[model samples]
Target: MISTSKHITVFEHQAIKLNQEIDGVLFDETRLKALQSYYGENGVPYYSLIHNGVRFNEYVGVIQVGETIIEVLPKADNSLKGSNEKKRWRDILIDMLFAVGIFDIHSPSNSSLKLKSNSILDLYFELFIKEVEYLLHNGLVKQYRKKEGNVTALKGNILFGKHIQQNITHQERFYSRYSTYDVEHNLHSILFKTIKLLKQINTNVELHSRIGALLLHFPEMPEIKVSESTFEKLVFNRKTQSYKKAIDISKLLLLKYHPDVSKGRNNVLALMFDMNKLWEQFVFISIRRHKEKQITITAQTSKYFWKPESGYRSKIRPDIVVNKDKADCVVLDTKWKNLNGYNPSPDDLRQMYVYHEYYNAKRVALIYPGTNTSKSSGIYLDPITSKEIDKECSVISLSVEPKIREWQKNIYETFNNWLTFGNDNVQKNKNASL
Candidate 1:
């Protein structure tokens, strides 16, 4: 039997010692081994194993080891370690994820999901459950599948060799193959696997009843060995399109889950996201949503930079590129870390410089999460002459707001204003380029 469930919350880069009791929760040996083995197999860099404990990296999410739950949350607000701060960042992370289309919840009624959920895992489980229940309410999609079995009546094509081999003794039975339309298919199989996984790892009492109902009502599908490619092979049409969201969440939950085969002590399920990548996506999507009709906002637009004598060529892609009226382009790179009253790093500045020259961008900026919303301008200096060049790069700090919509609006407005006026030198460069 499992021991009493313990929930521990830690911020990014925080460490928890193994074989120790803290905050009234014990980080026992079994749980630590489970995590260690998981990290060994996946090597995700979500956490690093230390001499005494594990330190979580920039990947923030929830991981379950047996009955123990570890929730690692993102921390951009400095070293303020408090429960209130944890809750605040947790909500912010979820909101950012929602904006970036990570938590693809389709239910109209679930718009306020951030307010009701206790953890990110709970939110995922609940969203998946709702999706499955919706499909069950409407009906499962059926498809034509070829099946072979022994039958009394001659239906489909019958193989004389197999018929004689098996049905010789019983002349009434005929082994025949036929195509029957049914709900059994790869999509349902994936969903069923996700349901079983949720049944095992889910600890939320409120979600238990809903999960049970899904298992009871959902069609029994063949168990499949799910992989990253398994989801890649799926093809959705009109009939299967409704299952897209559910299958997406399923793919995430099923793929990240690693079960404990030895001693069956701890099973780890990590649902972590790289804050840097998430920040980039969130900014791009937010701006795209509210940008002017004439402006074009694209993310990760790649351009071949260095071509080698042989093999693959090097490519450079900025996080976001905005083209205004197809005349001037602005590049924006997002970083999740706080600048803390320091100038941007030289490497970062150099990257922005390349983006400026390669993309011919009117301006480039490194966006950072900060307490105050502000922007600073800097010009590149000539390497030999020590004179300022016409090129300009700026650093913009955006304050995280309480509401996601307000935050998104702030992103669009701030980005729009920056693109319009820019710095004094950037405006001059824009006029010079035109």
Candidate 2:
């Protein structure tokens, strides 16, 4: 049983037990039901309670929900061996950061730096706190003017209406003063709320201690849980370039944790991500870095006619579209799966075909994390009767080998080249140049 234990490790297909009462506290049935619905749609529950036992779903990482602590053992490989622990942590975090749109989260090849101490989440929280602290120590304060209402002094624009009612007694002696506290800044509030949030969800003693220490710097600030999207919209100009790190850290924190919703309205924290969409975005963005002239890459394009629907129909959003000279060149969709299916699962292949049909592209491909099981990296298939019979669809793989150690150049070169050469027009141009 996992109830008594503060933390437990489980591997794939492993079975444990969860009860209505765990750690001497009753569980919220609504959240469990919500998780059940999510798992059912996701296929392969992260944690399922059956007559057999509590099942560990396919995926690896840490899951902390309420008092229940789950430390899932990842699929161990050479990359995860003791010697490669640093790279293992770096790789996982880099990908997670990429998913959350935290591009260039660190500089000077910090991804290659070795960190031996904390778990992935704790490490992130620590780095984030430190980044904010760096900004604070450097005297980069976020300033904004607030409206005023008081009796002593009139600073900024005071409401004469408020003064007329409350300050009537001391009108000659005092005036309203609108003072924006030096300590109460927007960034400080974000950091304060994030730290308060980390305390609630995270159980690591060391991390808690570090967070408490950091909270001292933000002694007097309102605890406001702002919208996750607000962090990404933050802008820091040349004058306050120091706040760049804090803004970046804020984006990651918001991305990592979604505000918790359950029985009681007390705001808590739950961290999760749609790995598949993140992988798709990461692939698109990484390949985009090597973009050559005369070629363009657009992601999540909705211009094409995916279908003709009147009700209960949504426009299809292709993960990426590689274009040449304003024409649709190739349609690419990325899947987070390890490509273990019998043959590029028909569901995925059909979706690619639909993308090709709707967009009038020369080729369509589904990119999956290479597990080395598929013999060919770009396995193209043709010859099904259709309007664009000549067009090809392939299942391509980019090995997410957690072992690669570093984000080496050309990691996506093959895929990028595939996207470029996939266009018959570009190939013809290259041949003519030759």
Candidate 3:
């Protein structure tokens, strides 16, 4: 029974305005009068129809008149470009309209759309901005922190100690520490494990080739030409064809002839070793030749403490040692693990402490792999100097993202910083002596 009271033109489109009084009212006076006149004064009821095919179900017979009329807008026929074209533009437009606090196109019974202060796109942009800021502020290669535990020695065997009276002796033992450096070491260890696996299958020339291909993208290796019998004896048919065999043979050949792949890898390792040696040379040159400030780095250079005067010599090698003048030094040791994101054991810390005491170093740093939250640098207190020194030793964790250039930068910067710290210490000591 709704009837149009007025018409308006907007954007060259005609829209109808209905009388507000007729809202929700069936058989209004105007409609009833029209029906009666159309029926020619007959008492029988006459049905009336509205012109528009679209139904106004909610309002029924009533229509609220307004200055601005409701219009059926034409659909946009043009296609959206790029990403917009991949999705429905109409749906996106509708959502955008809802997001901006415009009229809701959903069910009327539903609650009003609540516009968020920040959209998903805004949040994504913020995250990207933060990542970019981190990359800019901190170099691609940076130091990370690791958590390590104190070391304690193992007690006597209680396997058959039923009475257990005399075995109650207390011995200094170390437990593992939780650190980030351990995590990185573990990651490297995985690479080492993969290398080990490839070594095991080295006898199977075909398998070796496949492994090499899988691990590296270098050119194919020239096939080793040997007598069929010798090849069978050395490689194909073996009682034990495990990875251990491959590693052993590879090591043997590396020590003997210096095979190309094995030799190249060894050379790279040797370079790392040589770099350790060259650090001293670089420092000396930088100071003496270039007239720059004196710098020194510390590493584990001695192998005496690990050896027992009475029993078999322990084959422990210290990772790194930093010496700044006579009094200040920092010792660092690296360990590789097979687990993901593991912390150092207490035994490791004890070993480090032993190095600290033997070398008279001020700090003992235990490095490990870094997780997301543990990317920052941190220091740990030495248990021995807790009362006297307040800060005895430091345990730090570093993050490595596995890029060649990044690795080089990390090594350079780390050594450089160590040198700088050592130089400062030397100056302070010189002033004190004066």
Q: Give the per-residue lDDT of model 3 (tens digit) for 71-116.
A: 1111122333433432332233233323333222222331322222
Candidate 3 lDDT trough over 10 residues, lowest sum = 266-275
The residue-by-residue lDDT of candidate 2 on 279-363, one tens digit each, is 6666776777656766788888885453455644458788988883256578888876565544677677678777777788877
Off by over 4 Å in 1: 1-5, 19-23, 78-81, 112-115, 324-327, 424-434
Predicted model with the maximum lDDT: 1
User: Which whole-number lDDT from 0 to 100 does residue 134 have in model 2?
Assistant: 64
Query: How much does each candidate deviate from the true structure in C-alpha RMSD?
Result: 3.6, 7.3, 35.3
Residue 58 deviation, candidate 3, in Å?
A: 71
Reference-based lDDT, residue 5, model 2 = 49
**How many times do residue backbones clash in model 2?**
6
Model 1 per-residue lDDT tens digits across residues 86-157: 788888888888778876766785574533447888988888888888898888999999999899988899
Q: TM-score of each candidate?
A: 0.93, 0.68, 0.28
Q: Model 2 — which ten-residue stretch has the worst lDDT?
A: 425-434
Q: What's the C-alpha lDDT at position 44 in model 1?
A: 67
Please report the candidate that would top TM-score against the real structure: 1
